[model samples]
Target chain A: MHKFANPTFFMKIANGIFPWATGISILCFAVGLPLALIISPPDYQQGDTVRIMYVHVPAAWMGLMVYGVMAASSAVFLIWRHTIAHLVARASAPIGAVFTALCLVTGMLWGEPMWGTWWVWDARLTSMLILFFLYLGYIALGDSFEDQERGDKAAALLALVGSVNLPIVHFSVEWWNTLHQPAIFGLKGFSVNAAMLQPLLLMVAAFQFYYIAVLVIRLRAELLSAKIRTARFNLAAAE
Target chain B: MTRKRRRLYFVGLGLLGLFSATALMLTAVEDNIVFFFSPTELKARTVAPEQRMRVGGLVEEGSVNKSGGTVRFTVTDTVESLTIQYNGILPDLFREGQGIVAEGRMGRDGVFLANDVLAKHDETYMPPEVADALKKSGNWHPEGATAQAAEAKPATTSN
Candidate 1:
């Protein structure tokens, strides 16, 4: 892990993996979309509206999973003082925010048809909204400080503080009487039928690979900017 | 200790304090955070007449009746049930023996006066064919059985 602190080495590995990530993500989407949209049976209750879960659930999962990655990388940055770790956290924010936004939008679409309300202040829904805000807050706070290091530290702390919401978001349905339903996949077993689960898993994998491909691109840009900043500082000192 | 080690400890302790504080606050506000109350909870706790709240449970089988613009139904948590009267459009998913939540106030006449009605579906999802097979085999039970076990039992037993 410490060896990855070297930017050149890190980029080498990232470049190697980027093509594979993009290819697999596209392949998964090629298969998963049809499976989710056309082949998978309409729900006994929800019919075609159930198809929305293919996108909504995976987006929600990505939102949470990306936040987990962000928080973990933030921890690594703070503890190890690794610039690459900070870059990883910074690169993750916008992508996670988009995924969260997708989750919310798709949820509203499904909710209007099924639940009769576009939104509700239920514990699960409210906590997820907070997650979205946390991502925005992390991004805003990171840019607020003029001193880049200070900004990074502050944002890292915020990321750690906000992690308390993750468990609350997950268990909110179980802990409270929410309009949202409980998790179909639980410790006991999947309550969903195999036919639906297959497509859902495929979409989840597709999203995971897509996140990785995008993260590598973002990280490369971040590295270039850092190099430029350092070069400018060196030129100023020589003058 | 080295400076890096000290920073690590400082960060670790700060996080610990933050988590404990959050945990305490969440516990303190547990009641306020709950989205709705079941019929059993409503009955156990005294609520002021006409106080706004949400009640959730399964729509009792054979209990929905529509009269003009008003729709009346019974919501049962399998332990206790409440009569709800709503004067609005129900969601597409609203049906007898399905989960629903009604937001309104308790009336003076013992019926709940709901201004909004939202259908709450369970977690279970399957193809119509699988659902039919489950029904035919007499093994189909709705998810969250605690709330719908009574209504679902008779159908299963008859089969």
Candidate 2:
């Protein structure tokens, strides 16, 4: 774990995993898309509109999952002063934001037809919206300062603070009388039937792999920019 | 303590404090955080008739009355039930014995005059054939199934 703090070592491992991630992600999507959209049975109640769950649920899971990654990495960066960890958090913000936005949009699309309203100020929905804003805030704050260290620390602190929303988002349906349904999969057992669960699980796997593939590319870019900045600073000192 | 150790403690304590604060705040605003109230909850408290609120419950079986543009239904949580009157298009999922949430003010009369009606779905998802079988077998429950009922059907499985 300490050795992984080295950016070069980290990048080497990331690069090795990148190809596998990309290949698996592509394969999952290739199979999962057809399974989710066409082959999977339409819901007994929702009909074709139930197809939206394939994308919406996975994206929602990714949104929360990515934020958990970001927050954990931020903690690692702060505690261990690992540049790679900080970079991982930085690389994840945009991707997490995109996933959150996708979740929100797909939710609205699903909601409009099924719930009779495009938006509601329910606890689950509101907490998720706040998660999206937290991602955006992390990005904006990280780039706000002239001193990169100060910006990183500030943004990392924000990530930690914002993490309080995660549990609230997950349990909001049960904790409150929200319009959102309770979780289909939880500690008790799966409420969803096997047929729907297959496609849902496949899509979730596809999204997870896709995130890894994208994160590897973004992490490389972050590493390169950090290197260029250091090089420029060294040149200025020499001059 | 080492500098790194100190930083670790700082972060750990910060998160602990933040979580505690959040829990307290949420507890303080518990009533406001609930999106809607069940029929039993609504009945348990005194609510102003003019104050707009959202009430959610299952639509009672055989209680739906549709007349032209106006629709009337009883929303029940098995413990208590409230009459809801709405004038608008209902969602595709709206049906008798299905859960629904209506937003509006309580009228001078006993009826709740709702401006918006949203259908709420349970977490259960199965194909039409399985649902038909369950219905035929007298094992169908709208909210969720009993463990015994679920175990009886080989076709029914969950992750």
DockQ of each: 0.51, 0.67
For model 2, the docking class works out as medium
User: What tens-digit string does per-residue lDDT give for candidate 2 at B1-159?
Assistant: 399999999999999999999999999999999999998999888989799999999999999999999999999999999999999999999999888999999998889999999999888777777677778888877765533354467565432
lDDT agreement of model 1 with the native: 0.89
Model 2, range A1-239, lDDT digits (tens) per residue?
59999888989999999999999989988998898888888878888888899999999999999999999999998998998999999999999999999999999999999998999999999999999999999999999999999999999989989999999999999888899988878765666667787889889999999999999999989988988999999999999
After superposing candidate 1 on the true structure, give the runs of residues whose Cα lies further than 4 Å from its correct spot: B145-159
How far in Å is the alpha carbon of A7 misplaced in model 1? Answer: 1.7
Model 1 alpha-carbon miss at residue A199, Å? 1.3
What is the C-alpha lDDT profile of model 1 across B1-159, one tens digit per residue? 387788788878988898799878988998899888999999998999979999999999999999999999999999999999999899999998899999999999989999999999888777787677666766666656522332343343222
Q: Once model 2 is optimally superposed onto the true structure by TM-score, how far is the C-alpha of residue A126 displaced, in angstroms?
A: 0.3
User: What is the C-alpha local distance difference test score of each model?
Assistant: 0.89, 0.90
